[model samples]
Target: MAMSLWNPTKRNSVVLGLLSPRAMLTRWPSQWIGGALADSFEACVDVQRTALRDAGPAAFDVLIGSSWGGAVAAALIAEGAWTGPAVMLCPALSELRRHGAIEAIVDQIAALPAERKAQCLIVHGDADETIP
Candidate 1:
């Protein structure tokens, strides 16, 4: 998986972009949490953990996730895997539930400590049918 680093300001920032399963089918310049598609949700998280270990969690400044990837990003923070800021765009929590993915992660996200929860920003559109 490719992780991009850019100097948006005086300080250099590393942005990890996690693409959704559908997005993976496209030619978008993003990657799954793991370099390859995972067979289970836990496998996905494991790859992210490995990435953090290899790259150092502190190396990342922000996490940006789209659709199912958003759910993964939220899980990382909720499970204390990542302690940095994240931007989740239309996380596919409902779709995950439908596909038999872990449901408790959602609760875990809601129950996150205020300070940690504040580090995440979720963007959802009211008219979005896929993730509504």
Candidate 2:
């Protein structure tokens, strides 16, 4: 379930996220894609780590995320790190910059077909501009 358009949580499920930048990333105020991307990526990892630690003896049995978090989820997937089913919606992995990253790995994320990628639930809105 998407907690917000940007953040969502899957209770009792292990999740890794790649969060999107705030709308300001799209605005002219501070259009630094690198920082936003890095920050979001790092924050996501931190959250996952915390969750894993909190799991203590046992944490997540599945992973879930949306938007920018999808990218984070993909990064973990690519690294062959983490375990559990994954879910991504309206992911931003394809486009690194929301005025954030200089580039995106959307193709990389999408490249992994259903057979190759982790068992997951992915959703995309027809009206989204992040699509390439």
Highest-TM-score candidate? 1
Error of 2 at 86 (Å): 0.8
> What TM-score should be assigned to candidate 2?
0.53
Local lDDT at 29 for model 1: 48
After the best TM-score superposition of candidate 1, give how far the Cα of residue 20 lies from its true spot, in angstroms: 22
lDDT of each: 0.65, 0.55
lDDT (10s digit) by residue, model 1, range 47-94: 677887799867889998888678778778778888888999998777
Clashing pairs in 2: 3-8, 14-62, 14-63, 18-68, 18-69, 33-100, 94-106, 96-104, 97-101
lDDT for each residue of candidate 2 in 71-106, tens digit (9 for 90 to 100): 667666554455457887777755655544424445
lDDT for 117 in candidate 2 is: 62
- RMSD over all Cα atoms, model 1: 10.4
lDDT of 2: 0.55
